[model samples]
Target: MGIKGLTKLIGDNAPRAINTNEIHSLFGRKIAIDASMCIYQLLVAVRVGADNLTNDEGEVTSHLNGLFYRTIRLLEIGIKPVYVFDGAPPTMKSGELTKRAEAKKAAEEAAKKAREEGDLEMAEKFSRRVNRVTPAMIDSCKRLVRAMGVPAVEAPCEAEAQCAELVKNGDLFATASEDMDSLTFGTSRLIRYLWAGTASTASKKGIKPTEFALDVVLQDLDLTLPQFIDLCILCGCDYVDGIKGVGVVKALNLIRKHGDLQKVVDTLKKEKSYTVPDPYPVEVLRQMFVEPIVTPAKDVVLKWKRPDVNAIKKLMIEENQFDSAKIENGIKRLLAAKQKTSQVRVDSFFKRATAPNEAERAAKRKAVAETNKKSKKSKTQKSSTSTKGRAAKAKKDVT
Candidate 1:
């Protein structure tokens, strides 16, 4: 869906460049998340043996469940998340959408065939790929997020583009999405594998989320941001076809030598097998990547408030038939975390208020040491004077 083979390209070419850390390491950070991506991931990952979360009316609720719990987990760990939703798709994305629909159809057929053959493993694998986020699912997710007091944004175009814009404007610390396209969208930092840590079982023990800083990636690739986008395009972007016989490594090398996309196109034109597009809208794609429509910074309001537990219970437990015990337990955890964070802030405030400044404390200690030294000197001098007088009186008695 992003630049095809882009993640692999970074792994192979610039190994040891991206940052990797535990999920909790993002504490106290404000992250702009691509909600659509998260929803798709949750829908795919939450299934158990072809069974997903559904309510009384047989409506799928996996997206809501994932969003609710995931947001709670983020809050418990002190992460402030702003969920950005996708609005209308850009005209260029129409082709990508069609391709995805066809792929999902093929996956569905493959899953059916696998099920008929009694190959459960293969069927499950195919089924995961076929899962899609629906409009109803989006609405449910938004409702859940609102009840939890997190910001939910409707982006003008791609959610990742808006996230990138927020990060660039300093409204967010980074963008969270699995798609490597966030990098091309000019996000200063991108987070991946956020859902990888949901399980603590032995099989999922080694999986952890990773962070990628754009500056480090660019430094490792020896290219500017624009050049990196061009490299991604050459590797293959969703908007256009790439030249035949050109791959990621080859693209990087060409970009390194040519310095720009136009130069790279001119060089590739001379090749016998490589055929550049006639009306290559590579420029247009670049423009979209660099600057996309997004909500202005002035309009964005991010404030964390107390979770509406009654509303959450009514929606998830009463209406949707989610386990009441689980919801209540989660609510308790949210309350506990809120109190704990508040207590921490109060403790920190008093500690700072009562604690003396290092410089003043040092000066007081120095003065006390000097006074002790002067008193000790006076005692020794008095003792010597008394001893001399006693000796003088004894000499006079001997005379």
Candidate 2:
């Protein structure tokens, strides 16, 4: 859905461009999140076996549960989350839109068949595939977010594009999305896997969230941003078909050899085995990625304030039938995150300049030292194991 093979290409070729860090390290940070992606993730995760989270009226509450809990987790960890929702799709994306709709229809049919066969697990999986973020769900999320005093932005087009814009404009510290195309959108910082669950959960599962910087990737690949976008198009993007026989590796080679899209197309034409699409909208797609429509920087307002407890309780408890104890605990945690800092300001949602007192600074320094010491020990153990394996292999060869 995102630049088709971009993530894999980067993973295999430029591993050092990715950075891994803990949730605790992101305290006092403001991140712009792709709201639709989070909703879809939550809807699927809340569905277990043959049961979907629903209230007494039989309306699905999975989306609400996921959104509420995940947002609370972010707040509890001292991270301010700005949710961004998508608007009208770009005209060029009509083909991709049709493809997604067809896939959803197929998934729905498969789920029905699985249910008829009493295969609950497969049915559940397929059901999740058919999950769509509906208008009602979006409204509910918006209400919940407002009640929690968090900011929500409605993007002019793609949410990822808007999030990237926010990061570029310095309105947000980073953009949080799983989409690889966010990188192509030129977001300075992109954090992956911050949806449906807490970052700590990912860490515990040994699948830590990765933070990607646009500059680092550019440095590693030695390509300008415009050239990188061309490389993505060559690999395959939402708007265009990839050249036949050209995978991510070949695409990168072509881009590296030829600095421009026109040149790349010319090179492909010379090759007897491949053909470029006639009148390919390659330039249009490149421009769309480079200059996506987004809300003006000055129009965005990020503010955090005391949550409306009674309103949140009514929506979750009386309407959605969520556990009172759990909701209360989440609210308590939000309050705890607030108490850690001296001032919570509306204008500076993404920045905190408070200087730590001597005692707090000393404790932080000690904690950092311990962490570094443990890291050193872990590296030493791995090195020792590698040396021992090589020695054993040598002895076997001698024998």
Candidate 3:
């Protein structure tokens, strides 16, 4: 669903762009999480015999349970997560949406058949495909996220795009999601495997979370942002069908050669080896990726407040039948975490550890001065391409 095969392709091709990061290393970081994506994963993961975890009222609580625990864990570790919920989907995604709906329906039928045949495993597998994030589920999650003192944004369109906008606007440090499409949306940093499972479980399973840097990717691939978008399209995105028979490597080669989607399409027409979709909607898809619809930066407000324990209790305990003692313990832990983080910020911690002493600084300055006295620096001396500058470019208007 997410620019199919793009994650593996990037890992294989752009090593500089990706790095394994310790969770504690991200202390005091603000990350924007794709709520819908997380909820879908949670629904799949926390299941009870092909059905979701539900309360006495027969309403699903898996999403809430997973989100509550995950968000708390992230916060306790000093990583402030901003949950971004998807609003309306893009019109360009109609084809993909329709296909998904059809697939879900088929899975439901198959699951029914399998259950009748007493193939529980097969039924469970197919039943997962039937899971969809409903509006009510999203609303409940947003409420829960807010109750936990996390900021929540209802993205105007795709949550990935909105998260990207936040990163560019300096509202967040990264986009946390399993989807590679976050790169296509222009998030400066994309975090993977953070929400794949519980931290202990992930550690035991050897699942290390990684952060992807887009600037390094662009620099390494020797492609402009537009060209990179074209490359992703070629690799197959939800918006448009990619050229038949063209793979990730071939797509990269084509984009590097032809320069853009239109040019690539033109070349494909001449070469019968690859089949392009009839009436290929290149311009529309390009527009969707290039200038995705997002809430205006001025209108967006992200504020992380103190966790309202009473509100959380009301939602999780009084309403959803979550154990009162467990909820109370979670609140205490969240408060303790907040207190600890408040006393020691990540920046201060890093500065204390890494900053040079007076003697060392003086020696470094003397060495630099002597080197500069004898050196003729080139104007073209390459500086490292970085994802860090995206923050300093933040406008004065937005809070």
Predicted structure with the largest lDDT when compared to the true one:
3
Error in Å for residue 329 of model 1: 0.8
Report the number of the highest-TM-score candidate.
3
List candidate 1 stretches off by more than 4 Å. 200-204, 339-399
Residue 281, candidate 1: alpha-carbon lDDT = 71
Candidates 1 and 2 compared: the better one by lDDT is: 2
lDDT of 3 at 155: 88
Decoy 1 TM-score against native: 0.81
Clashing pairs in 1: none
Clashing pairs in 3: none
TM-score against native, each model:
0.81, 0.82, 0.84
Worst 10 residues of 1 by lDDT: 346-355
Candidate 2, position 349, lDDT: 41
Q: Write the per-residue lDDT of candidate 1 for residues 1-399, one digit (tens) a residue.
A: 788887877887776557778776776678898899889888887766786788889888888787777777777877678999999988877888999999999999999999999999999989998988888889888888888777898888889888988888877878989889899988878888765554434135766667877766776676767788888888877788777788887888889888888788887788777888776776787887777777776677877678888888988998899899999998888776664333222232342122233455557667999999999999999999999999999999999
Evaluated at residue 337, the lDDT of candidate 3 is: 73
Residue 276 of candidate 1: its Cα lDDT?
86
Identify the runs in model 2 with alpha carbons over 4 angstroms from their true place: 196-203, 270-272, 341-399
